[model samples]
Target: MRLLQTQITPFVNNFLHIDVREQPFLFCPLHGKPSFHAHPELELVFILEGFGKRIIGNQVTYYETGDMVFIGSGVPHIWLSDPAYYKQDSTLRSKVIVTYINPKVFESMFIHIKELDGVKEMINQAAKGINIFGDT
Candidate 1:
């Protein structure tokens, strides 16, 4: 017979979702360009309505209406309206909401379901961010 030692894992150790006290919103002027910034919380970005290019890590993607994305913590990213795709006075440039979430929240939610195993796997494979291109 082999003896096995039991080890206790701390509750929510190394994992804890960030508590966002308020909604997420980021805006830049039509001609303004912002630098990439990182946060401790995960981010969920949904384009209410707009056409712009998102630069995450080394990936640059263009998006239209209904587009959405999920950005992981500490990932450097930025969105800039493609000047070739819009006018300087257009409202489309400032319509993206980047919602933040803590990674621990995801891990905790993922632990509760067996069916979500696949989803959990997918999340692990996701890059710094995942982009959802909307139907044109």
Candidate 2:
């Protein structure tokens, strides 16, 4: 399969990054904030493949393909994939889609858009982090 890591790049004209790392899940700087850290930017993360534990704010849970979560500004988070993905000769890979949104964008959108009440409510609740599941 073609490597997904090569597709990662800074979003043009936006405060965003398409962080798609393929392997060595631990301490992979390309994963950027791999440890517990918080930023003012809101973030939405989706797992296309791999298995791991995800820690966001006060919630800790095992995650796998199709796992998606939304994190609000200043909410600390981290993605710790299984150790197998880091072993030499291992073929395991991680395909994740992480989209970061500047708080300023959210502020402006919610300020004048009454249609975003549902979205606003979700983001507000996201301060504690939100995990989405059950598409089947």
Candidate 3:
């Protein structure tokens, strides 16, 4: 497997010099305002605890412990918990582990291949949104 250079966002810079590291690590406090933002790199998130909903473009889904979500590059998204769950002394925010990679990684594989037509189609559909239940 080829080693891909992952972009290190400022949000992750305070903890470590992730820019030079092979794999970057980002940690955000579980509680915060509800908002969505677009990323330039693909994102993988693993929820360790708490409850919330992840909004990917127009698709919104509830997530809890053990929930894992893979969001491709440039797809705007956010996670928010119900007000009922957010209270003093409550750990309502989800603990997430996120990994980001360049979209070129996929483009490098499918951007110029005729045999990868199916993958090309999936990439197109991904531009809309994709949610796979972990139980499957």
Which candidate gets the maximum TM-score versus the true structure?
2
Clashing residue pairs in all predictions, respectively, total 2, 0, 0
What TM-score would each prediction reach against the true structure? 0.60, 0.79, 0.60
Q: Model 2, which residues run further than 4 Å from truth? A: 1-12, 15-17, 26-33
**So what's the TM-score on candidate 2?**
0.79
lDDT of 2 by residue, 21-54 (tens): 5545633364453566676778788888888887
Ordered list by lDDT, greatest first: 2, 3, 1
Residue 127, candidate 1: Cα error in Å is: 2.1
Query: Residues 14-70, candidate 1, lDDT per residue (tens digit)?
Result: 543222221122332221334455554566777765566777766888766578887
Residue 27's C-alpha lDDT in candidate 3? 23
- RMSD to truth, every model: 12.0, 6.7, 8.9
lDDT by residue (tens digit), candidate 3, 1-136: 1222334344443332212211111222222234466655666666656566777777877877677676766777776665556566654444555655555555677758889888667656766556556573
Better of 2 and 3 by TM-score: 2
Q: Count backbone clashes in candidate 2.
A: 0
lDDT for position 40 in model 1: 48
Task: Output the TM-score of candidate 3.
Answer: 0.60
